[model samples]
Target: MKLKSFLSNLPARVILLIYSVIVLYPLLWTVTTSFKTTNEFYENPWSMPKSFQWTNYINAFKEASIGSYFVNSVLVTLLSMAICMILSFMAAYVISRYDFKAFRWMKKMYLVALFFPVAFKIVPLFQLLGDMHLLDSLFGLVLAYSATTIPFTIFLMAGFLESISKEYEEAAMIDGCSRFGVLFRIIAPMARSGMITVAIFNFMSYWNEYIMALSFITTESKRTLTLGIAYLMEVQRYATDWGALFAGLVIVMIPTLVLYALLQRKITAGINVGGLKG
Candidate 1:
């Protein structure tokens, strides 16, 4: 029976292995290439570096102005994620806990927003930002990111919130806890996994987002990591600073990698918990 099951699953295991390699190979190549000198890369392209060229990272930071972009990205992503998560949490709490007719359409609206492409709304967003004198500013980009993500963020957290037992809130209220207290002191702890999951996903989205950053930020000083990478690519086309280019790519990828590594278990648990309860 064991042998039969193993044989039946062999093709699936093989396919999964192939897919994993396909996804990981380029990431491995990029990491290897980031540590190689231009001459070494040109000579072999696929071979491992003779020696790790740490200068590639230094040059990427100093010469490519990626350090500034990195800071900008960090600020924008952190602030945007904070705002998105806070608002989404509160909104999701209400939507899930309340049995009101008024709130019924709100979830549907957010679902609609999920499908609504930001591209179609860019013109209005641009005009509104410009009117508010926020165009080409990091704050503007932060606001744009926060507002746009709220709908989906709300949707995601609402699922987890819905999965939570209202008895927790009821008991807290009986113990003299205010509604706000019940939310923060009681419900928030129970929904910790969901919050982490939301934070991780939003962090990745805010970090890697390029199109909105590109559209809103015209000033070189305010550009995010994504813009910095794009600018690095343009410079590399003529300069051929392959080492710096790859280093920039690696730098861009590091945060998301760290975040996922740390919170991957919570992400899985959050989803499973929500799914089972729902």
Candidate 2:
């Protein structure tokens, strides 16, 4: 019986193995190619490098000025995420705990907003930012990112908040905790995993976002890592510095991979808890 069961699953396992290779091959190729010299790449694109070219990363940072762009991205993403999380937490707490008509309507509105694409808001956002003198500015970009992401963030947060028992808040209140204190010290900590899950999702979205960055920012100094990579690709088209281009890509991918690897367990637990309770 055991042998028969194993034989039945063999085809499915083989198919999954093939699918994994197909998915991972491009990523593997890009990493290997980043370490290859121009001549080595041209000679045989499929072959690994004889020696790792650390200079490719150096050129990407110094020549392409990816360092500055990286700083700008970090600033923008962190600021936006901070703002989005704080606001989303407060709003979700209210929407989840309060049974008022206005809060219910607001919840529905946010849910409806999630269905609309970001591209739909481009014209109005551009006009609004231009009027506010925020166009081409990093702060403005942060605000735009925050606003666009809030609806979904709130949605996720509300689910987690709903899962949390009101008894915790009530007990804290009995112990002389103010509403804000209960929220910050008790509720926030209790929902820690959910918060991290939402944050990681937002980080990836804010980090890799290109269309909004391209549309809003015109100044080279305010460019994000995504913009820097796009510009690097354009430069590579003429200069053919494929090594540096791939190196830039690797730089952009590192943070996300590291963050995911570290918090993957939290992501699974948070999603499961939120899904089941909410």
Candidate 3:
């Protein structure tokens, strides 16, 4: 029995190891490539640098306006995510706790919104933003991204909230706690895992968002990381700097990697707990 159990687990372990390598190799290559000189990168694209060119990162920042883009990206991501979480939490709480005639319709409406493709709405959204005098602005981009993300975030949060027992809220109410008080004191703490997961998801989405930011933010300094990376591609048209480009790529990837590493456990736990309860 022991031998059979060991054999059964061996294939899964081997597969996991292979998968991990596959996922990590591109990141490793990007980091190593960032440290290679341009000549070295061209000569040995597949191998590590003979001598690391640490100045590539400096060049990327100076030449590509990576510092400006990095700050813009951080601001956009943080603001959008903050709005998404706050709005989604409130919407989810209402949908989960309240009994109303419009509840079913509201859920269906959110589901429809979640599944709808943003491409279809681009023209109308642009027109609307133009009318509102919000075109080519970061605030407009924030509102757009928040609107796009809210449906799904609300859905996830609502599902998680629905899984919680109503008794907690009832007990809080019996003790004369207001609705807001119950939410902040009892429900929000319990829903911390789900909130973290939603925050991470929203952050990732906003960080890598390209099309909306590109369309809404025309000013050079206002461009986010994705647009900045794209500008690097354009700059390479006349003078290609593979090392600097890779360095910029590495910089762009760091925040995402760090965030995932920090929140992965909470994300998994949230999904698991929400699933079991729901």
Candidate 4:
């Protein structure tokens, strides 16, 4: 029986291994390509280079305002992430804990919101930002990102909140803790997985968002990394810097990797932490 089971699993394991290699190969290729000099790239696109052009990173950082664009993305992503997390947490908390009519509507309504395509609202957004003199501004972009993301974030957070036991709330109340204290000290900490997961999703979404950034920002100085990459593409027509372009892409990917690496470990811990009273 054990031999039969191992044989049956072998095919599935082989297929999965093949799939993993397929997915990872392109990423490896991109990293290797980033290090190659232009001449080396042209000479042998696939083979390893004699020496890595570390300066490609410096060039990408300097030439196309990639560093400035990186800074802009950080500013926008942080503000957007903060706004989305705070608003989602509050809305989810109220709807889950309180049994009011309007709060009830929020749960069903946000579900409907997810069904609608984001493009449907872009024109109105463009006009609204323009009217407020916020077009092309980071603050405006942050607001746009936060507003569009809230409904979904709220839904995710509320689902998590709904799963948690209200017995915790009752126990806290018996101990003379106020509603606000119970929420902050107990509920919020227990929902760490939801918060981190939603926050990371929001961060990745806004950080990589190209369309909104392009539609809103025109000035080179104010462009986010997404826009900066597009700008790099346009600039490449006149001057070839494929190495730098690849370097910029690698830079853009680093933050997302770092965030997941740091936060992913906590997602499982968050759920179990609630059970440990001490």
Highest TM-score against the true fold, candidate: 1
> For candidate 4, lDDT tens digit of each residue in 7-126?
999999999999999998888888898998888888888987678899999999987678999999999999998888888888888888789998878688988888878677788999
TM-score of each: 0.97, 0.96, 0.95, 0.91
Against the true structure, candidate 1 reaches a TM-score of: 0.97
Give the CA lDDT, 0 to 100, for residue 128 in model 1.
91
- Specify the poorest-scoring 10-residue window by lDDT in model 3: 269-278
- 7-70: candidate 3 lDDT, tens digit per residue: 9999999999999999999989999999998788778799989988989899999978999999
lDDT of every predicted structure (CA atoms): 0.91, 0.93, 0.88, 0.85
Across 66-145, the per-residue lDDT of candidate 2 in tens digits comes to: 99999999999999999999999999999999999999899999989999988998889999999999999999999999
Q: Which stretches of candidate 2 lie over 4 Å from their true place?
A: 275-278
List candidate 4 segments past 4 Å from native. 268-278
Model 4 backbone overlap count:
0
Candidate 2: worst 10 consecutive residues by lDDT?
269-278
Each prediction's number of clashing residue pairs? 0, 0, 0, 0
